[model samples]
Target chain A: MKLLEIKNLHASVAGKQILKGINLTINAGEVHAIMGPNGAGKSTLSAVITGHPMYEVSEGEILLNGKDLLSMNPEERAREGVFLSFQYPAEIPGVSMVNFMRTALNEKRKYHNLPQLSATEFLRLMREKKAMLAMGDKFANRAVNEGFSGGEKKKNEIFQMAMLQPVLQILDETDSGLDIDALRIVADGVNKLKSQDNASIVITHYQRLLDYIVPDFVHVLADGKIVETGTKDLALYLEEKGYVAYN
Target chain B: MCEEIVLKANESRDIVIVNEPNVRLRISQEEGSQLRLHIIDWQSADNDVHIEQVASNCVTEIYQVAYLKDNQKVTTHTNVRHLVGGGVSKQVLRFVLSEHAKGDFLGTLYIAKDAQKSCAEQSNRNLLLDDTATMRTRPQLEIYADDVQATHGATTGQLDENALFYMQQRGISRQAAERMLIVAFLSEAIETIRNEEQKEKLLNTIDSIL
Candidate 1:
């Protein structure tokens, strides 16, 4: 079933148009890779989908599981099972990761009319997720993303995605700034978290991450629009020929 | 009214001031006496605080925090005099101002000529949430003695905009994010309170206001 459908979506930041007219549909149990060069509006698409306040959607509609996503606020959209794993996770000093995750999970649970998890239950779940990501015990007590290494930040995002278990996950440049080992660990975490009931959108510049995640579909975003869409072979073709030929 | 209290050796005291104007408190600690004071500067028409350590080997700690808004002006003066040797004193003060509110702090730490081997530190931090708000912080340190460690620092600034945007991106509303940042800013002073009930009550009060 289609989990998200974006049609003729045009977005602008600071009154300057960035995403001209974009159309895409994502279904469950599928991984979609969006590849583009710098200034191709790859990040803008993610920001607009996540309802970042700086971006203004000038036209078109976005439907998440047949609901109007444009009508919901950022938090409401998140509670509705739309998660964006930011390229640069925020560093919140003095706010422990434990506290932040607990609050986020509880808030999402409350939106679904579920009872709050007890402290023991929450901690157990956190430990399990961290173990899956191969993170250390110290991550739970440290400030949220504060003083964390580059790889740790990306892994923490995936870990949060695991805990939240959103229906549609948007991985914005998750492979950037990651070494070979860190890339494998992050890809492994994402692979483990995948299931037939959910899907993901992997935004990246290189085909290396696509080799691991193996997107079922590849879309080339250029000049604020998706200009090409094809199977995994398209990613290899672009990697060999580069984006200039496509433009 | 004037109150003069002496803390005997190895004694500890917890003082709570809710409402008062023009308060002059003279507190002297004997040798080995430890004084932990939490001065809640809330709704004081006018407030003044004076403390001194007259004996050696004594420890003094003072924590003062105030939240003011709506054209209210609060002035807090703290004077710590270390007359003897081998004593330590620490003072931490913070104020959150909003609307047209005004806050002023006068902190004075004096180490006498013969007060050797003494350590004194004072820090005053203020947060101004509104453009019209004003804060004046004066940290005065008079150290006449050699071989003594003394330090004082004061800073006043507005909320961090980047932090606010970061929280907003995480699906937290702007208002909730602001409240969390303000609470975190004030928690520095609130964490020093030894009484659990008092700390919780003050926290709840601050939350309600926000």
Candidate 2:
């Protein structure tokens, strides 16, 4: 039943230690919120799990359904159903959102030994997913995140999540830079995609997002490790009293 | 000096050159004439293009893209002369080089006396896929006429590392990501072609080479 397991993970970036040792396990149909201060290595944890080339994993083990994940490349990790919604999504000029998404979806399908979608089927699926994120058809012709507003970029990230349908979705500070309205719509879209067969990892600093996408488990990460893990009330407790308690 | 050609009033011309052994063109435009020129070089030694607007209210546009690898070297020179007022000229050029390939671009724009209110702009962008690839660019502007608008810029760089990682996180290999970024870089000029079939063919050729 366990979807992802991080055991004694230690990682470093640019020769500086970030993640000392992180151990966490997630089952199917569960939402885990990782709350930490600015330098607590929350993003580093996500990057290491996703096999970012910048990070040097000095020690530890990562497993997706008991398969060794650290041995796989970044693209291989993605094909294994791991997704990271980047906090600062890159802007690719002259590459349309439609072409990018189709290539990604088809690559995933090819990895799973499935046939590629026909043009009609691909467009139909794109329309269905775009409607979920309230994205307009104009985005299909425009470049990927080239001229999009902050809110639109965040929405586009979620739109991509819908198109890829990864089993283990990691939302890395998705609520940052989002207005209240954008936050609601993004959280709503994420909520609609939750199923019993998939899990999520929500990384954020504020508890405002937890009120919308309530997490089943909350973990306090400080000094490169999880200091505490508790139920939903822990989020409220941390909201009332900030991570200063853990500090 | 290449043989000179002229376009009469109210005329339009579209010229395309691809991997020619030698390219030397000089065109003179009469009143109310239009010229659209494209120069795509996969491998070449030298290319020279000059467009002169002799009368008023003429238009000129030039687009170029060059892809080179190994020890190939290419030099391109463009000269646009505005003799009368009420004319417009624009140029966009791109170069992609890998390995030990070298590229050079010299763009010259001149607005003669009494050629007031003429507008001209030039942009040159190059992509170096390897450390040894070299690009030399010189954009010269000589505007004797007062009350004219002209601008020119040039830049050389590598691919975006952040964008590459973003794509790899979405299941695209690094090779594929590089291809996408390179196509995105050069496609800006390719998009301006008026013919759809030619545009598609050139796009496919670029993609296949990449």
Candidate 3:
């Protein structure tokens, strides 16, 4: 079934158009890779989908599981099973990672008419996810993303993704600031979280990440539109031939 | 003027005051006494406070918070003197100013010549929420005894705009974000209250005011 359908979407930031008439459809149990050069509006697409206040959707519609996605607020969209791992995940000082994740997970669960997890249950789940990501126990007590290394921050984001288990996960440049080792850990975490019930959108500039978290379909986003679409071979093609020719 | 009061060893005292203009208070602690004082002045006023630890094994905690709006002006002066040994004193003060409000804090810590092995700490933090708002803070320490421990720190800044936006983007309204920031900023001082009921009541009162 189609999970998300974006039809001729146009978005602008500060009254300047960035995404101009873009269309894409994503289904369950699939990984879609969005590759583009700088200023190609790859981040803009994610921001608009997440209902960022700075971006204004001028035209078209976004449907998540057959519901209007653009009309909901950011948290409501998140509760509706849309997750965006920000390019620069916010650093929240004085708010511990464990508390933040627990609150977020409980909020999502509450929205879905589920019972809130007890403290012991929550801690156990957190420990399981942390061990999966090879994160230490110290991270659970520290402030959310404060004083964390770049790789740790990215790993924390994936850990949060694992805990929330959203239906549609948007990885916005998750591989940007990670080393080879960190990149492998992050990809492994993402791979472990994948299932037949949900899907993912991997937004990146290089194809190295696509090699690990192989995309079922590769879409080249240029000037705010998906100009080319193909299988995994398209990612190889873009890697061999830079975006200069695509524009 | 200085007033000497006896707490009768092992007794706890809670003092709450709203300092009026040009108000001055001097308090001296006795042996084995415990004192929790809250000084809150939200009006346009100038105030001075002096606290002295004259006896051993005494516990002193002072909390001062000010919230000013409009074109209000406030200046606070504090002096903490540890004259004896084996005592502990903690002072925490915070100021939140908006509009064209102005604030000034002068805090002094003195470890006397014979006050040995005493632990004293003073912290002052100010938040400026508007461009026109201003704050000036000075923290002075005079430690004449080598065996005593004294620490003082002061900071003046604005709220974290990014954190505010992050909260706002999550469906929390701007007012809610401001409330959260204010509570977070003041929680450190509030947590020092040994009485849970009073702390919760004061927190709820502040929330209602906001």
Candidate 4:
């Protein structure tokens, strides 16, 4: 089943065009990798999809499960099971991880007409997800991403993806600052969370991450468009030849 | 110039002032005494607090939080003096203004020549929620003893837009996200209340208003 469809989508930031005439379709149980050089509009594509206020969709449309995704706000898009693992996750001081996650989970549940989880139940769920990410108990009490190491911040993003259980997950440069060990742990968490009913878009600049997550299809984005599409071997080929050809 | 409040030797007191249009109080502390004062204002108010540690081994704490809107105004003036050695003082103040409201804060800290081994810290943080709202903050400190440690900081600005978007992306409505940020900003002052029931009540009231 098709999970997301982007048709000739064009987006701009600060009144300057970034994504121009891009088309893509993602289906359930599929992992699509978007590889590109810097300034190729890779991050802009993810930002526009997640309804970031800074990016405006000037033309075309995006559909999630055949529903209009462009009409929703960021919060509404999130409640609809759209998640983006930010390249630079914002550090929010004084907001505890438990409180933040609980609010998010309950809001999604409310959107689905499900009952809210009690405090005990929510804590239990948090513990389960934290253990899945190999995070310690202290992680639950600390403020969200405040003073966290780079590796810890990436792990926190995956941990949130685990908690929210989003259907359309966009991993925007999630492996940017990870060491070898942190990368493996984050990849393992992503692999564990994959299901037949969900899909993922892994946006990265290197092929090292694909060796672990393994994408079904790889597309090379350049100059505000996807200029090339191929199997996983395309990432390996780009790693050897470099994006000099595309640029 | 209200009645002068005096703390005898080894005495401790926790005082809370809420929503008074005009507040004026003078407090004197003797040796080994402690005072915890909390001021909360929801409407327009002018507050003046003067505290003096006359003897050694005195401790003083002051916390204030004010939220105003719709042409409401609040002014807070605090003067704290340490006369002897081996004393500690801390002050935390916060104000949130919206619409056409205005806020002003003046904080003064003085340490006498004999007040060696004294430690003092003061911080004032304000938030302006609208374009028309305004805030002015001035923190003044004077330390006569070279051995004393004193620090003060003041800042006035709008809410963090990045933090707001982060919460919104996590499925929280914008209104709800803003409320959470505001409460977190003001929690530093409210957390200083020693009374559990009073603290909870104040939190609920602030939550409802936001």
Give chain A TM for each model in order. Answer: 0.98, 0.98, 0.99, 0.99
DockQ (C-alpha based) per candidate is: 0.37, 0.84, 0.28, 0.78
Q: Model 4, stretches more than 4 Å misplaced?
A: none
For model 1, the DockQ equals 0.37
Check candidate 1 and list the clashing pairs: none
lDDT of model 2 at residue B7? 93
> Which sections of candidate 1 miss by over 4 Å?
A237-247, B19-22, B30-32, B42-45, B55-57, B82-87, B111-120, B141-174
Interface RMSD of candidate 2, in Å, is 0.7
TM-score of each: 0.87, 0.98, 0.77, 0.98
Error of 4 at B80 (Å): 0.9
Local lDDT at A68 for model 2? 96
Give a tens-digit lDDT track for model 3, residues A1-247.
9999999999999989999999999999999999988999999998898788889999999999999999887777888888877778878766667766776777777777999999999999999999999999899999878898999989988988888888899999999999999999999999999999899999999999998999999999999899999999999998999999867
lDDT of candidate 1 over B1-210, digit per residue (tens):
368899988788877665465667888889889888776655644666677778899898988778888887788888889999899999988898998888889898999999999999999999999899899999988999999998889999987766665565455566877787788777787878888998899889888887
Deviation of model 3 at B77, angstroms: 3.2
Task: Flag regions of model 3 displaced more than 4 Å.
Answer: B1-23, B27-47, B51-62, B66-75, B80-91, B96-124, B127-161, B164-179, B194-210
Q: Model 2, residue B57: displacement in angstroms?
A: 1.5
As for candidate 2, its clashing pairs are none
CA lDDT scores, all candidates in order: 0.86, 0.92, 0.84, 0.93
User: Tens digits of per-residue lDDT for model 1 on A1-247?
Assistant: 9989999999999989999999999999999999988888999998888787789999999999899989988888888888888888888777778877887788778878999999999999999999999999988999888899989999999999899898899999999999999999999999998998899999999999998999999999999999999999999998999999656
Q: What TM-score should be assigned to candidate 4?
A: 0.98
lDDT of 4: 0.93
